[model samples]
Target: MTSRMKPAIDIIDQRVRHAMRQVTGIEDCSAIVTPATNAKFGDYQANGAMALAKKMKTNPRKLAEQVIEKLDVSDVCQPPEIAGPGFINLRLKPEFVIESLRQMHSDPARLSIPPAEKPRKTVVDYSSPNIAKQMHVGHLRSTILGDAICRMLEFMNHKVIRQNHIGDWGTQFGKVILALWHVCMAIDVHKKSYFKNDFERLQSNKDNKNELYKICMQIRDRHDKDYINDQLEEFGDAKKYFGRFLEKLDDIIDEIWPDILLAYRFVNLLDDILPGMGLRIITREKKDNEWKPVERPYEHLTRKITVMLQQGGEENCQEEDAWHSVKKATMEHCDYIYQLLNVTLEHPRDSRGESFYKDMLAGVVEDLQKQGLAVDSDGAVCVFPEGFKNKEGDPLPFIIKKSDGAYLYATTDLAALRYRVDELKARRIIYVTDSRQKLHFDMLFAVARKAGWARDDVELSHVTFGSVLGEDGTPLKTRSGENIKLRELLDEAIGRARSVVEQKNPDLSEDQKQQIAKAVGIGAVKYADYSNNRTSDYIFSFDKMLAMDGNTAPYMQYAYARIKSIQRKAEKSGVDVEAELKDLTGIEFTQPDEIALAKYLIRYGEAVEMALADYRPNFLTNYLYELTQKFSGFYTNCPVIKAPPDSRRQRLLLCELTAGVIKHCLRELLGIEVVEQM
Candidate 1:
């Protein structure tokens, strides 16, 4: 089979293609084969005749019947029937459906899905939060959605690059640097006053020349020592690698002045790394009147991170190692998202941000200008391309420089693009960003094409998405004027998830609660964003997402959980699932719900392929939700426990298969967890 054609899929395609050719005498008519909008009809339906009815000079019902007479789908489907208003309803043979599911089960990949014909290298930019700030709700949607997109693309065999693109450098850095400088200055002033007069008076009261000399020497020695430089370098190396330990130090002699001050400064700065860098600081006040201790801000921050990371809800680790563990723990957290989402991630590359490209930005601009694709207008370099116009009907330019000759976002983006295309030899550059920057991206893609940095074969696409709005219909927010933080939002979601799981499945142990919370919380948030059309804005709704019915993550998860519960009972009873798989039988799909459920399950590969082509998870999400609903109806109507052995085995197998499909879809499409019970 060609990569595009699976056995069952090809059978359906051939049936439609043949019907179009025979009835319309036109081979290229657009024929849509979709699940029946309402399940009252057969398993699948094609509405190709509705549009063709006008052109063919015949009634839609008559044309559909004529088309159905010429169609051949015996290999994978029952003969087509003409339904109401020109709909070609299709029914799959139950034995055939069972065989298709069996074939999918036998395949190691579980869906019989194949990779793209031409897999190309692609770059995905996502989850780019600024350093030293908490990762807030402002960043949550993009991080989860973009990561899931990249994961899906890679899972389908594309060479994907995950770019964190942290905002490590900017004018903001200058602000932070100024902040740190003032803090250091104040601490130094306090240290100087404590040492000068206080030490001299202590020495005067002692009164022997030798004792005074010793005191002077001790004070002199203390002021000249430095241990912080060694500590900083050690911290950097440990965080970078997954190593057991950095070399430990034994106590040498005690010193008083310089060492203490230097250590204090380093500790103060390290406290800022908590929310993002994954570190904690703990401190206690000094009882001595002359020596006041620093407050334990780091410890509090570490506790917050620890609560998120530790399985048992404990926030205890070695102070020196807690920083490294938190960093490791954050990565573990990111990985759980990947696992739940069922996508692979590239080894993360820390290339920093726009300022990291400073050395190359100027050169890129010069090259664009030299190629005649860019020009200086009002002291700013811009690219004017064809067809794009402003509201005033003037040609719009993608700015590379501002009026002050400062580099702009477009320029940095172009430089990054050029580096990826020319230097990295990338075949594709897929940018995943918010849809508001559509014009910016369109301009960049056009200018890059004009500048000879990219070609049509080297794909450059901006996978733009809509804003995540709140219930108020603007953008999401708390009652507070400030933008809701990602960390805070996640915490709230997890807290709610914990309560939901506890109430629903109170029998789960503490460990299960923690694990399920991570899955449910993150899954609910991700599914809320991904389940809708990505190009359109979706209002964020916690209650709706966590609800037990209709196109929600929990509903999908609950389906899987119910199936798992059945499978577990079967296993406990020592039922031989594989041995129960039998060959020939009377095709027994009497119920419409059974037929509907079977049809949805068989289209698994097609849904994945559609999602892969469009880079839209909603396609798959919609498919899975329908599949779950159909299964739910089937389960309610068809009793499994009281059925005969052969039928019970078949039902169990069907349940097992449905669960597998749901698990795969949830991870691949929405990045959620499947609770065994709930």
Candidate 2:
């Protein structure tokens, strides 16, 4: 393989820092080289001498002159000049600029960008959708942002392990299984859509408690009857009926996937209202060598089922089968979303959910107890990591195991951390979650380090982002105040984009229009999220995102498509664009626009490095937007096909490089596609 090319800014920074080290006799002196604010001064300016002189208590201007005497950038830059206040201004030589562009043109795969000097195995955990639930608007930022982080790191030659820590275990599954059983019972025994009707009824009557209580009572009565009748059937247990239902679970999954959310909500409503209603239900438990009958409160049914599922064995085979079926259905839903969004999470490979670490929870608690880091607090096993306090001025507990013998999210996260460190051999682990979980991760990292599960050298980062708000400055939701489903949101975006494409270029073929619509629609949503700072909340607007002008995806896509059009036109006019670019020896920068675009083109690697440094995609987007504007200027002022014979190849070369950079950054790094024609 060819060697990677070091970025120009990095080279300049190293040279200036080396010169500073020689002048001050400091082993670790830094030259903070940044892009010049004004092009009149220079392309880049180093502002380190002033700070160093102050630290050493010497003349700033004299210090800059001493550093310049030792600076040797003759290969890339012109003579370095000391500007006001000991600032060193340096401009790239024309030959150096031409050589950089030539190198980038030759290396199309990576744009001649070098990998990191120290590549490490990095684990990024993101897009953790719960089992038996549809992903909503809340999951948008983490999913795309985390995917971009992985792409950039991998492009920089790091071994990236993508973890989809889905919520597949715990009390939720019991309710889900119960909901599934209700679906089966409604279809098979009652020959009616009982839960579907009850779901709507509950929603409509939720405000009237008396009517809601009446509905809950009616549902509980039927539930109790079904429970008793199944146990007293010819098979002598509920297994035969549920087992037969599980045989055709796939067909049922397709039928109920759309209604699973409704059924789940119905169960939750019942669980909340059926309590303290003095209702009872019959259940079975094994005693000695026979099945014995037991009665429990109606509301406690789901919890009992949860315990049964957690304690896996031959008798609980029905629950196990149901759990697997539910998980399979839920993941299929999530996989569709991932594919739709162009995300890189593959099912069963990148998916290591909470259930994967179930067996290790006990061992984690036991080890913490042995290490004197865990103790019983209010009947729960807790570890009070230092520096966290409650409002009452007491050390807050990081509860691992609850008083009811249930493991919390903290326990699973700790187990996951240990696995990533020891098994995956990850030197750095990033958790891409919302800002609300900042305190949780803070305590998690502290507890992990205190328990020696995460070594000091291991880098643990909680990459938090702000929420996507509606026009009203609140979290985006449907008219019913429910989380908007991700699938529906994306579909609406594509639908809206289709209309725009139809109006703009109605004569295009249907297939072409569809492709453009998909690209523009999906790219717009992703680019809008990426353009904003991850730490600041921004209002989500389809109108703003889909506009044809201003820092939007449609604008960027259109820019790339325009360049492609120019190339095609050149080909039709008997211009062998490929041969010209390949045979080109050097590029002459005669116009101001040409020089401006060329200078910015060589700094593509700098943009990638800055984005990777802070795990922010906005930095990359900002660079691309600026590049597009510069290219626009060049295209308007310096015509490509109409240029003179000598300048033709240089203009074409600029177009090729501009298109190449935009496509790589958008499609490869950001997981957003660009249309060849729009």
Candidate 3:
């Protein structure tokens, strides 16, 4: 394997630290080399000498001079200068900058950056959407953020396993299956549009309790009748209607998503309203190999069905089939959003949902019990990981199984963690979720460690992010206070971008405009999110994100397009631009803008390292934004296409390298598309 190239800053830090070790006869001293705070100081500064002086109780400036005597950075930086308080300021030589640029230009794929020295098998769990529900704005952060992390890790040559831990099993699936049955009966049996009509009516009359109650009663009565009648069929409705419906489900799968959503709402409405209305529904249970009818409260039907699905027998095959169909359809919908966002999550391959660990939940709880880490607390199986407490100053219980014999998220997560570690051999497991789940994961990791499921050497991280807020500083939602569906949000972004593209460059072809619009629209959304501190809430503003200025995606993308335009213009004027850059022997920087841009270009690796250090993408975004600003200064101050013959090739090289870095960062690392034209 080829050795990875260390960043210029890393090389400098090594050299400076070695010099410090030689001067003070102390090993393991870090130079703490950082970029110069002010441009006038130099490109970088070593502040370790002052700290070392403090440790040695000596004059700082005098210690700095001694360290500089042993520093041999003449090959990379000019002679080091001692600044105030013993800061060692170093400036990169022009030859060094040129050589770095040449290395980047020669290797367009990686830009001369190599993989890590020791790579580990890593698993990233993110974008976990529930079965039978459309992905909403709430999932946007985890989906894209996790994808970016995976891309960065893969770029560093780590063994990355992208796990889409979808919510495929739970109490919710029972309701989802019930909703599917309603859809089937509404279309195949009654042959009416009751689900859609009732959903709209329920929404409009939600504030009117009397009217809502009346509607719910009417729907409840019909549902009861249908349930009783369906059970009359041989082998119940499980084999009669639902099984056949599942057989041809794919034929109308695309058309049923809307119906399924409406039906789900219908079921939820009934569950909320008909609870205390003295409603009863007839369901069945198989006892002694004979079917027996039982009366149950209408509102609790879904829960009863959930118990049946969990118990899983020959009698509940229909419920199991329905569960599978719903999960499949939901993931198919999620895949569409994944493609639109350029995320890498796919079904079956990367998707390992809660259902995958359904059988293991009991074993997880049992093993914890055997280890004495889990105990019965208030009739529920719980693990009281140390340091977690409630407001009453009692140890908070991390509930694994409810008193009703139902496993919760904590149980499923434990199973998944064990599988990732023991089966997948993952050295590091990262769970990307919102900040609200911090306590859950803290206890989870603690319990896993206590149970010896995840060893101390195995790295487990819960990467949390703040919610995306609307202009009102609340979580982003629709006007109706519903979670905004991601598909609709992305489509609106592209639509708005199209209008902007139309206003800016109307002469472009329709296809060209569309391509640019999609790139700009989606890129703006992802970039805006990535540019913000992951732990801070940011307002989702399409107008600001789409603006052609500042640190937005449009600005960075436009910077890239402008560079490509320069190359195109050069090519049109009978200039063999590639040939000229390839034939160049050396670059002499005569302009301040050239030097500034060249210096920032070589620090791309440092930016990557910083971003990866804390798993904060804002660092890399901040770097790209500054690089674009530097390139703008260079472009304005020094003309690339019309420069004098002696400097034209140098300027052209700078433009090419700038474009390459921007494209690689945006398209490859950030998963955002870059266009060649506005």
Which segments of candidate 3 are over 4 A away from where they belong? Answer: 1-4, 55-58, 205-215, 233-240, 272-280, 286-290
lDDT for each residue of candidate 2 in 129-237, tens digit (9 for 90 to 100): 9998899989999999999999999999999999999998777867988887787787778988789898888888878888887887788789877776556443445
- Candidate 1's residue-wise lDDT over 72-161, tens digit each? 887667778887798888777777786677666665354666666678888877766553344556666567777777767776788876
| Per-model TM against the reference | 0.73, 0.96, 0.95
- TM-score winner between candidates 1 and 3: 3
In candidate 1, stretches whose alpha carbon ends up further than 4 angstroms from where it belongs are 1-10, 18-27, 49-70, 83-87, 169-173, 179-347, 350-352, 582-587
> 1-678 in candidate 3: lDDT tens per residue?
323467889999999999999999999887989999998899899999999999999999999999999999998999999999899999998888888888888888888887788999999999999887889989999999999899899989999999999987877777888888888888888998688888888889978888987887788788777776665446664555666776777678678878888788778766777766777777777678778888778788888777677777776776665676677778878988999998888888998998889899889999989888889988999999889889999999999988878888899999999999999999999999999999999999999998888997799999999999999999999888889999999999999999999999999999999999999999999999999999989999999999988999999999999999999999998788988987668568989999999989989989888888778889989999999999999989998778876699989998998999999888888899999999
Task: Indicate the residue-level lDDT of 442 in model 3.
Answer: 94
- lDDT at 244 for candidate 3? 76
Q: How many pairs of residues collide in model 3?
A: 0
Q: Could you tell which candidate, 1 or 2, scores higher by lDDT? A: 2
Query: Worst lDDT window (10 residues) for model 3?
Result: 231-240
Judged by lDDT against the true structure, how good is candidate 3? 0.88
